[model samples]
Target chain A: MPKPSPKRKMVRFRDRAKCRFCRENVTHIDYKDTQTLQKLVTTRGKMLSRKRSGNCAGHQREAARALKRARFLSLMPYIS
Target chain B: MPKLNLSRVYEAMFLVDSGDAASWDDLVKHIANILTRNGAEIVGITRWDERKLAYTVAKRKRGTYVLAFFDLKNGLAVVEIERDCSLSEKVLRTLLLKADHFSVADMRLQLGEDIRQDVAQRLMTERGETAAVVHAVVSKPTHTGGEPVLPEPSGDYEPRHERGRRSERY
Candidate 1:
């Protein structure tokens, strides 16, 4: 078997939580809060997925639905 | 009533008086119940209590925000939800939206992006460009195709030193 590269081993460390958004409580992920929801949604009115946002499963789900609701009500733009 | 497509997602935002949070909770539950009874999927519910509004709404300066996200069959649910919101004295405002174009897969892709900066930067860039274009147009008269003429330098024109001193006296 080929030797495992040190860079490959270090990739796991880089994946650890370094996102400032998640660290700071600035963006409150609330399903009912359109102002906050607008931050998570895309200009095309699509909700950003968990892999991209680094939000835990529970919060990601909440944010996604909130974005959808905000878009539906025209509080958030549905399409760019 | 026309049959609604079962796979559509819907989201709603509602504001109620801060004093009426308890009352609004029951109303929100009722909406969830109705959606459930009608075979809608209850995705999530969030209650944001005791927040100040950017501007006074319904003559109140503060209110509680409730957000609900669900998937339901399209039909009279939208109308029914609106009617309920209108009848509830506790509810100051309500907004309902549909997420027909989004899917579970799409949502998965957006989970960890820094959306706030992205949005703010985009808005700022757009505004900045517009301002720059407007400034350029205003500074150069529309009829002039050539470069703008520089005004002649004159001693009567106050230098920066005098301009600062003059404003200080006012």
Candidate 2:
């Protein structure tokens, strides 16, 4: 039997243990933090999902609803 | 005796005068103390800091923003909060939303690390670019194959790219 070529090693990776919302001490995430939340919010004014956002579970939940409430209050754009 | 259960969570965002930063902190603390005394669990409190408003409110050009998320035993607390906020001169505006199906687990899944990185990258890229247009195309449900019908523009102005095959039609 012909020798099989060596199988390529699959590289596995893990995400860093840091608050994605605040990588640096200076970065802040606020509901009125429209500039920051704007980056997280969808054009439709919905907060992006965590699976998509990579934010820790706690902050993601807070950020999502914050963005939504911000939109309803006209603090953020529903469609922009 | 009857068991008391609360099913609704609420998220509130309000604006305070930026000039009175100390008063703003005190106001938030007062609201929180009231809620806790009334059996409400404070879920999270985020200071949104200050920024320019999209439009003027109460003749003010700019205001400080604050967000408070909590769970109340019932909607009664919400009503009281709203009433108090309405009467407060320092509170420029306030909005409270009932979170029916709020789940932290689901939210975390939606904003995982990879996604945050992408958002960070997009923001950086967008900042480098000028006047980028964001196009939102909603897909229509298919009917028996003819040509896919596009929704008509509801506004007087339509983008040139969306006019589609104008020369061919002419």
> DockQ of candidates 1 onward, in order?
0.02, 0.06
Q: List model 2 lDDT by residue over A1-80, tens digit each.
A: 97654452111113456656556532224443455565564444445545445567778777777676666555775664
Error of 1 at B10 (Å): 0.3
> B1-170 in candidate 1: lDDT tens per residue?
84445456675667777676756557667656755766666655555334555456778866665655566665566787777677767667788777443333222222113123343244335334331221100110122222223232221112223335542331
Q: What is the TM-score of chain B in candidate 1?
A: 0.50
Candidate 2 residue-wise lDDT, B1-170, digit = tens: 74577345565667877675456558767667756765666655545445556556788766666655566766677777887777777777888776433343222222232123342344335335322322211111224323323233221212223235641231
Q: Model 1: residues >4 Å from true position, as ranges?
A: A1-80, B1-5, B22-27, B34-39, B101-170
Model 2: DockQ vs. true structure: 0.06
TM-score for candidate 2, please give it.
0.44
